[model samples]
Every structure is written in structure tokens, then in C-alpha cells.
Target chain A: MLVDPRATVADMLRARGISRRGFMKFCATTASLMALAPSMTPKVAEALQKARRTSVIWLPFQECTGCKESLTRAGGPTLENLIFDAISLDYSETLMAAAGHQAEEAMKNAIRENWGNYLLLVDGSLPVDVPEYSVIGGVSNLEMLKEVAAGAKAVVAIGTCSAFGGLPAARPNPTGARPISDVVKDKPLINVPGCPPMPIAITSVLVHYLTFGTLPELDHLNRPKSFFGQTIHDRCYRRPFYERGQFAESFDDEGAKAGWCLFKVGCKGPTTYNGCATYKWNLGASWPVESGHGCLGCSEPNFWDWQGFYNPLSTTQWGGYAQIGAAAAAGAAAGAVAALAARRKQRPVGQDVQEEGK
Target chain B: MPFEALDPRDAGRLEALTATASGAHGPDPEACESVRGRVDSGNVPLLLNEVRYALERLLDDGTTHAIDVRAIPLGPGEEDRLLDALGRGELRAEFDSLGRSEVQECAYPGVWCVTHYNEAGHVAGRFLEVTFTPALLASPPEDVRTGLERLAAELAP
Candidate 1:
């Protein structure tokens, strides 16, 4: 195949000092991760070699910029090499060199020139309730999102914000936050959710698209099945602790120091899903759970509103415990009956005992 | 004779194994440390331990009738394959006859799964795990789930 002179996975990898062997290994890893056959690696490798440069416009909305922070700290190569080196990231309001009118002009030009081919990566929610809550260049985020998304080839909703309205859209959503799916129905949308999804997850999606020229298969939630398919509980390292009923009751407790399960300490790991454990944060050094913190389940929809951060799963099923209380009451009744029988036996034949009781 | 006389050292090993099983004594510190080291090294045995530990916690026993496999980054047509296996009674029978479930809880979020099996050694529970990274999807499709299932089987105490 006549590999593209530019934008090939090899060229990108080489620029990062990754050897040809390492590049193939990466492709093989990607292919395997996608659940593709071993034979598919060559195809993926070829596709990536021939793939065209994909222009991406990353927009930060009303957010703490945590998503960007996580992306910057993503595992693998330097942050610049991962994003700027691979994809033609035309404009990132956070990182772009241009500023003021020049920045805005560059964005406008990218959208106009790229037209239906560019990818619009949105990292926050759109506040419809209050236009004044989040504004960029005198226009609401919703307005700019709709404008750019209209001509986009595809939309990547980065983080829980853009994916599921995130924390902003939690109960009593003050800004009436809405997900990207709600507004942009014209194109395919890939929801890469998390408080800020694993940075490698974000970059891998770009790699998959570059290699396959299409987004990876997604689950019902529009999340890439490869990443958001399973629950955090399923792959938790503390699972053994959970199994043995060894749990950390409180932060900094004995069990916590022993690395016991946090299920009793309001760990949402069971129901939540993400690759925090296997692929630790900050270049695979360590994640929150490894550091003795419980999972907050920031990826799931309305997590902040529904799943109580301080509430443990064992205590959450309040009704189940009610049954236990009932059982205890029955046991008490049985105990009372047994005591009465014992007293009657101790008394002179049944007659005198009843009379004395009366 | 079918039975061979045991050497004194062999007898000692048997006694040690028995004591460990009785919970009067646990695996020696060196042995425990070796296992921990293996796990940290990402050895295949780590996967087995994780799967088994999860099963023991969830099912109270590693007995089941059927097992269903869900690969990381579930493939596009993989569901159909599973459904077919389930419908034809192959999967259901495995659960009906002998199955067990296993779960893997990684530190990362969204990398969990469950499996099922039966009392007669069939897998009845689901195999669940989270995958926050794309690296998990880097396994060969056919082998991934099967390998997981095998590891889960080994995880049975």
C-alpha cells in the first residue's frame, strides 16, 4: 500500500521515538483490544498508514477543566505528542497558540475548510436554563456547539459532561444542562465518559478512527464498548477483600491500611465501570482506589444525584435490613415463649402458676 | 501395589498441605509473598486468582452449570454468537449442568463483568470486569473470552 506521506501511525510513532517494532506492537495491541482477529493487525496497520489526517476542534464548556487535565496526564507519550502529533488538532481553546480574534478566526477557518470532515470534541454540558451561566465570545456554549456540530463529520463527547450532562445535569440541574446527544442528532456521537475519562481512552479512540477510518463499536450508551463496557466492580483489585468480607469501614481505618475492600465504605466500584485499576492514572502509577479512596462512580449518568458518595452498598438496601429486623422480632417472640414454658415447668403443675400470674 | 510408600520429606509436605487446608496454618510467608509478586508482575495466575476470588465472594462456592464470555471491547457480532450458544442449549446447559460466576474488580472504573455456573461444577454466574483503557481490548477476539473463562475456572478455590 502507498502509505500516506503524512499522518501515518508509523510516522507519528517514529516522531515519538517509538521503534517500528513498537509501532506494530501498538497496532497489534489495539487490534486485540478491539477483539479483532490477529489477522486484523496488518489491516489496521495498513489503514493507519494510508489514513488521511483528521482535524479535531476541542471545545471546553462550563467545566472545571478536569477533563483536559486528565487528558494531559494520559498514559503513554508526552501530552503534546499524543494529541498534536497524531491528529491535526486545529484549535483547542485551552492549548491553541492563537488568541482573541486570531484564535476565533482560525476556528472559523477550520470549520469552513474542513466542513463535514472535522471532528468536534466537546468536554462539558450546554446550559439552556441560563445562557449567562456559560458564554464564549458573547455566545452561549449551546449556540457555538450547535453551530460547529452542524457541519461536523462526527462528534466525540469527551467526559461525563458532554456524554450525559455530567455533574452539571445532576438533580435539580440549575443550568438545565443537556448532553451532546440531545442537541446533535445529525451525526454519530461517541460518548467517552468519566469524571474525565482515562486519557489513553480518549487518545485510543482517535487512534482507532485513524486506523479503521471509523469509530470503534459502541455499547447502548454510545460509549465505546471496548472502554465503557464493564462495571468497575468487575475488575477491582480489592475484589478479594470484598470476597473475604474484609472491608474498610472508614477512611484511614485498619482495614483501609490493609487494602481491604471499600464496599462497606461507600465504594461505588461495583456498579461503576472504567479502567482505573488496570491502567492507573499519571502514566500508570496509581489510581484513587489504590491510594485507599473509594470509587465515586463519576462515569455513570446522574451519579452525583443518584449514587450517594458516602453511602455504602450494604446499607443502601434499607428494605433488606428491614427483613432482618423482622426476623429479630420473631426471634424475640420465640425467646419469650421459651422462657414462659421454662417458668411453667418450674411451677407446681400448670394450675397454680396461671392463678398466680393473673 | 498401587500405593507407593512415602518418603519422610513427602510425608512432611502432605502434612503441611493438610494443615494449610484446615486453616490451622496458612500458606507460608515466602509462598504468599511469591504469589503476591506474581500478581504484581501481571502473571496469568493473577487473572486466575482474581476470577476465583470474585466467584467465592459472589456465589459462596465455585460451582455452576454454564458460562458466558464477554470480551473486553465486545466485538460487533459477538453478542450473536453468545446468544446462539445460549439458545441452542449449549450455554444454558452448561449453566444447567455445571457453571460458576466470576468477577474482576480493577482499580480503574468500568472494567468489571460477572459469570454464572452450577453446583455440579458448571459455571452459572456472569463474568464481569471494567475496561477504562483500550489496552484490554488488545487481546485476540476468540481467545480473550475463552482465556478469561479458563482463568475464572482456575480461580475456583
Candidate 2:
């Protein structure tokens, strides 16, 4: 698992004994994950063939290690993990072998060596009120973020904690937690917000950066539009049940057995935007709704403080039933047109099916 | 005293509820079948038209095209209908690399259905490729070079 600093992604894959065909498969999957049309597969393959390993600096602060666990503890060695492994991860408190001053030196050296070129990834929130509340190696979270982000080409807020000041900023905030965006204003920052964002979402962002040398288009929230453009309700398999007004009343109701919508039982999918319904969790095995539970809306800002998770969305002060219905209809229509327009916009100019010289 | 406190009818209902809850991981097969029979998103016709356009492009020029089947939201059983309409051709090729891959030509010339599976045997990607022949079917140049070197060494006397 020794990766050469200068090796291209293709070179790294080949060194790992991956054949060209395997590389093609990887590109194909990457394109799909990035929501790029299948025609872009060759372009992905070509770009990856020349993509040099990027130096990534992962900083963790006031938060649980769930995001790291989600990225690394996916059921098995997925292509996403392989691509992540290809990156030159110079610093990570949990993942790196270096410790204490040695780890600090690695971080500083990585910044000095690849300054203005390296990508910065932050996973927890910053306790701005009392910086000492979340200090690492004697450096306050706020100070460390400001210092590291200055040298980064772009900063990626890896989870809801870093992106939207997740649980730490929920309610009655003790130390006044804040998202990375609040602190870092100069650099381009993209949020991949989730309780622990989808593994593919994280990898897809990395690959998008690698392939095009630019971050993917972002929504108003600065989350990748490709992965978070649509609400979970838009793509839920039980959407038909919701449309038909068939919902499970209780956990073991007949409707529950029949796989009806959990909307009445506090599913926040209608408002929560993430790729959980589409890309799914556990390598497309199942998500919360599929397991007969309501969506906790973990990806949204202040979700932890959202009215009781067991109370139906309609019961909350967010909206009434009629408003929800109207919104759903309007959102669906607009989403369709927007999706089609975006697809057309994304297509590479001039070659339809295959690029020239293919 | 505990047995007397619990009603026999309540115990039976609880057992039934437990069975129902445990099976809630996925949609019931019967309901799925019923839904599949009723739902038609009308994507097949549009996809077929797309395939026709791709074929015309391939015929007019040497350009090839690929449509990701997984990307499109086809309604229940719509994929089957589309695949059935395409109809399988004589040639079928399978490649084992990162996992399993099957490339097969459809009834229409230059129309192909390509499927790639991961090591876990789950379908990772599915594409409808419009080309004279899939590029994957060809031996990569690097592999050919490696083969040549190995063969030459084997033949050396």
C-alpha cells in the first residue's frame, strides 16, 4: 500500500494490479456516482489516467468520529475506498500513524510542500466562543481551521458537524459551535453534510475534483448539487405509497408490513436533501426508510433540534398538510425541469455518443 | 400470576405483530408484483427513441454512444420491457477483471447491452452502448505487450 507521491491515479491503480478493464469499470461507476452521463465515462477514464495523486489534509475537531468510521468502515473495499486510498492523505489525527508533535510537523510540512494546491478536509465543528473547549495539539479549532484553510485550494466540510454545526450547535450551545463556512470566507468551501455523509458522496467530490480540476456544482447550501439536488422523498421507493396516501400508522401495522410510506410516522424525507434514497447506505443494501423507520433528516441543519423525530412532519410548525401537498407538487415539477436542463448543460459540447478519436 | 395477567388473544396478536415487524426490511413481494403490474412511467418509448437516435449517429458517422441504464428512473418492470424489446443477438462476451462484466449485442446492429458486476456479484453498472463493437472487448495494448514479452521468453531456447 505504498503510494508514490507523483503517481497518477491510473498508475496507482495499475500498481495495485488493477487492469485497464478494471479501470474502465471504475471510471464508469465514478461517472454514475458523479451524475455524469454514461457518455462521460471515457472522459472520466481519460482524466483519471492523467490525474496526479492529490495531497489531502484531514482535520478533526469537536465531534464524534462517526464520519471517519462511515468513510473507512463501509462493508468492504469499495471503489470509493480505493480512490480515497489513492490520495496522498498527509495528515489525519485518527488515520495517520504519526502522533503528537510528529503529527503536527506532518501537517505543517504538508501545508508548506503543497500549499495553495492541496485540498483541505475538515470533519468537526469549531467552538468559536471558547476555542480551548476543542483544542488539538495545543492549537484551538478556530485557529487551526483559519491557518490550514489559508493554504488550501478548496476546503471540503466533510460532515454536518463541519458543514452546518451539527449536534454541537443544536440547542443551548455551551461553547458556541460554528460551521467551517462561518470561519473560512476567503477559500472556496463545499459542504458534504450528513450525519456521516454518504461514502460515495465524499469520494465522488474527490474524483470530480481530480477529473476536472474543479469542484462539482454546488447547491445554495454549498453541498454538491449532483448528490443533494433532490430531496430523499423524491427518490424514495415508497414514494408511490405516499402518493396513494397509504402510510404506516405504527411500527408493526399492516401498512408497515406492506412497505408503505412512513410519512405519517415522522419521516422527514420530504424536506431532507441527500443521496440516501438513491445511492443508499451499506453499499445500496438499505436505508432507514427501507428498514421501516422514518428519516431522521440528519443531513439538514439543526436537525437534532427539529421537533420530536417520532412526530409526523405535518404536526411540526414547519408546515401544514395542505402546504406540504402544494409544495410537493410544485417541487416535483420544478425538479423535473431543472434536472433535464442540468443534464443538457452538463453534456460535453459537440460530440453526442462518442468523442472524436475514440 | 403473569400468565393470568396476559390475555391469550393479546399474546397471539403480539406474535403476529412481531412476525410482521421482522419482515419489514423490504417491500412485500406480493405488493411489489401488484405495483409492477399497474405502474408504467412511460420511459421505455423515450429510451427506445434515444436508442434509435444513437443508432442513426453510429450509422451516419463512426461515433459510438453509451446510455447509463442505472441513471434513468425506469418504473417497475420497465427495464425488462426495454431489454425485451431490444432482443439479444448471437454474440455474448464476458470479462473477469475487477469482477464480472458481460457485453452482449442487441438484435439491432451496433446496439449493445453492457453490464459490470463488482467482486461481491452485485451489479455495479449497466449501460446500453451503441457501437460497432464495445471497446472493452478488445485486448488492451499494454496487456498485449505483456503477453508478447511473456510468450517470447517462453519461446526462447
- lDDT (0 to 1) per candidate: 0.59, 0.78
Per-residue CA lDDT of candidate 1, range A1-358, in tens? 2334355656666555553434544555455445454446668777766766788898888677898888764422342233345577888888888888888888899999899989999999889788689987888898898899988989999998888788887656799887888888989999888988887678768877876778888876788877765666555566545544566666545565466766666777766657775555654334667545678878776667653676764433322334424533564453333234322322111232235346
Model 2 is docked with a DockQ of 0.20
Given candidate 2, what's the lDDT at residue B41? 48
Candidate 2 local Cα displacement, residue A308, angstroms: 2.5
Restricting to chain A, the TM-score for each candidate equals 0.80, 0.88
TM-score of chain A of 2: 0.88
Which sections of candidate 1 miss by over 4 Å?
A1-7, A11-19, A25-41, A314-358, B1-157
TM-score on alpha carbons, each prediction: 0.60, 0.79
Report the Cα lDDT for residue B79, model 2: 71
Determine which window of 10 residues in candidate 1 chain B has minimal summed lDDT: B89-98
Instruction: Find the candidate with the highest TM-score and give its number.
Output: 2
* Quality of candidate 1 docking, DockQ: 0.02
lDDT of 2 by residue, A160-230 (tens): 99998888886666878888989889999999989999888888899899888999999877889999887
